[model samples]
Target: MVWTVMPDFEGYDEACSQFIWDLPASYNPAVDFLRKHENSDRVALEQAYPDGRREQYTFRELDELSDRLAVGLADLGVEAGDRVAVVVPQKPQNPITHLANWKLGAVSVPLTVLFGTDALRYRLDDAGVAVAVIDPTVRDDIDAVRDDCPALEHVIEIETNAPAGDVHAFEDVLTAPEHTDIEPYESTPDTDTAILYTSGSTGPPKGVRHSHALWLGRAAAAYNFFDQGLGPEATVWTPADWAWGAALGGTLFATWHHGGTIVGYPASGFEADEAFDLLAEFDVTRSFMPATALRLLMEVEDPTAAYDLAIETFAVGGESLTPEIVDWIAETFDSVTINEFYGQTELNLVVANNSNWFDTRPGSMGKPLPGYDLAILDPDAADRGVAERLPTGELGEIALRPHDRSVFFDEYWHMPEKTAAKEVEGWFVTGDLARQDDDGYVWFKSRKDDVIITSGYRVGPMEVESAILEHPDVVQAGVIGVPDDTRGEIIKAYVEAAEDAPAHETLREAIQSVVREHLAEYEYPREIEFADALPQTTSGKIRRKALQEWDAQGSVDEESP
Candidate 1:
């Protein structure tokens, strides 16, 4: 019943010195995250609806429900290693479906409900999913893609009053006579657990294969970064979709792993007011926030005066935190500990900030977690798996030597070449580029290809975008490299301004000036373009590739040379 990193840590250095990898001999998410707590009276989940309603469930209740669902899935012909797609929002059904899949030793394919027919078909067909458990909202999308995904055998919809289709209802399936007295599948520590797809920022989304071992690595990071430990009284929440590994593993499972409570808002996206309300209403102490969510929260004024919040820990990532945004968090949440963590969806929780153990640095991702061996390496040598370490303060690809394979992903599902390309010598190369300070903190620069080369100088687009975000009128910004006969490539910026700010030459010059002052003068964008909105991914990433394409086609509105 005891957990490591509980109740007290002398300091960050000691935690690292004494910390050891606690990999379990046998692991299954259904057991480690849920079943172990089935006898306890602790609350497991409290999900909220936009229509002013909240539902709470205990670990014991979920254990029994998942057992029934597991039995139903088996009846539907699902077996060990078969993929079961989960396409639902942040309701109890989302976690229940995942638990059922893992209980049956089946691999879960979690797709966001935001996906359309093409997106759904690609993942369903690729993962060879046999059964899909979905929300009524996305049932039509699943129906449209069923023909293309021949492996999809049946669609099970969550109980809703809406007209039922040919598919079976979730509640009806759980009530079957076979639901009782079924034995759960046994699993090893290395048993393949889930296949999570990437954000597809660069190209098509690749399925990332994970095992039961992934939880230990992610939980360890959460333990330290989430203010040393989360106890039974702790209530955790995040604006991130449960489909993302960061939210599911880093937030949901991590909370239940410690017998704590988790709150969920099953909305499609983030709203600043709702974020504060959820935190206040649930008395949420632990929170995992993406940078976009923080940015959205920043738009509001004096939130502490508006909401009765009891937040203690604010763990943030998913993108770079502009200097301004960082300052706003420190000032606004004066009572909360703000820890800025860093990692890609492919391999997360490796590097993070724990302010309770050390001095929190501004604009820096904290030191590597205890079990991880991380370093900055030559990006060019990464594809060949060459372990070449870059000097301190030098920007290079962040790489890790998987001393423990459980903490990292197994491989890109069915993409060995892509997986192999991720390593440098024996180190796993993170596609992200950063510089490590002498004190061992990492400062993220940008993605590998996102570095813009202009007139014999290299520029990180994030630095430019961050600077532009500091402007009073700027709402969103995207930066890219454009081909130029003279400079090889020139830095260009696309900006979305506020209603009060006009798309004029003066506004462009003012934005350019901010960047020049914040970073090197050469790093400022040479060309500025104004638009009503900049292209962004569903996760709030500024799609610079789309910006480049638009620029190439000369379709940018109000472009200024």
Candidate 2:
């Protein structure tokens, strides 16, 4: 698929001459996009499974299936604002359920398979989910707690042969009704569309409710700014789960909203070679993956040998992109851009590397995306994290004044107190610290809570992590601060060494030496611990909170942090 790259933000409409944004009053992203390109030659999805089973669908067919699924759901008593919980891997059925919920004006809450019974039950009860679509493999845990979930009325198993008690086969629902009798419900765009939950370090996960306007508005801005190169004919791959804000808002919704195609490689397993082969076979134009997968790909002496598909935009998030990974992509695939953006589940891409801007700044999460107002506030100021807003070329906590509140995450679902805690007046405190250069580019410093304060000096973990990654023996690293009597908190390093390197005290000292030489003495890690592998969430991010907990519990007894 050929792409017409926009020369500037002003030329976005010209590059995609047929670009149109006409959202209904109750603008569900699925229904809105399906209505526009129901008859167009737009490919809605292309799935290639591990066993070689492949399937493709046009926009019109996807719309029809969603309609049928909606009719079936309505028959099951799902009403407007009702919650439909889906726990499935990356499959076409996932998208089907998403649109089906939108068609009925209900909320589609996608739960990742990584969560166990406890997490699942919390979400099921918290969101007041009535209908649940669980994959047969992971449905056992859900069934165990099904009795306790009072709001849960129906449990539909995806591909299970055994039909236990109240559980119904997923295929039965799809085939029950081809009826187009389902009427479109009138929904206010500002009403709650989804309830996304996010996990915390201390307690259970918190649900974040997002409205239809927030979903579409974030999609529109991201569609216009970050992905100007994608055409309506392009196919994109996002390794992230749809549960993630970046994937759901940035890739999934934005792609369909802009009338583009979404391609999938729904492999439940992680195989670097097989993943590379699939990339080559599909000729995927745009793909979003985490840095760890990209790092593994770079380990291949010549990445082009396994997969030589034309990658337009190689984007990554959920973790900071190291200089080595960024430099490798630029040196190997010069045409493909390796860009990083800053955001959380609460908001979409508030800052990103614009497509037309060829300038790539390693360690920097680019400037604010177009149509966003950002300010870096001093930490000592009265705003708790953001003291006073800093001017251009200053360092402070990165805060944003969203142009439209409706386009942001509605609020922490049922956690009004926590939502009120995050919102300082009107500006959303991102909990991140950054410094802007003279060119208006924002450089990530650290998370406000994650920052280490020693001897009244502030230290950013990313800078130290990047420095440690440069060491020849180190493969991955997660840095944090532990209670220190001398200093307020001392920097500690958790290192994942190269496969051949010995996990010994000597290596720990050597790692410390490297950090000390590369960065400031205070910035160097005072304590170091080696690990076989770092604990990460399903999204491939090192869970620093879990590591910190392990330190407190003394469970990781191998070495001291």
Candidate number with greatest lDDT? 1
Assess every candidate by TM-score.
Answer: 0.95, 0.91
lDDT of 1 by residue, 275-363 (tens): 99999999999899877678778888999999988899888877666667668877987668888777666776788777887777766
lDDT of 2 by residue, 1-561 (tens): 111122334542243343333444545566666667544556778887888888888878777778888888888999998999988877777878888888788998878877778878888998999999887777789888888889999998876666788887877777444466566666667766788877453246788887777566556545543456555766677777776777777777677776677876666766667767767777777777777778777767676765677677777777777788877887878577776766777776677665455466777787766445777777666255333777877767777766657666878887787787566656777778888988777888887778889888889887888888877678789888899988989998888888777656878888888888888889998888777777766556667887797779866644422
Look at candidate 2 and tell me the lDDT of residue 294: 81
User: Model 2 reaches what TM-score against the true structure?
Assistant: 0.91
> Residue 27's C-alpha lDDT in candidate 1?
71
Question: Which residue pairs overlap in candidate 2's backbone?
Answer: 214-407, 381-387
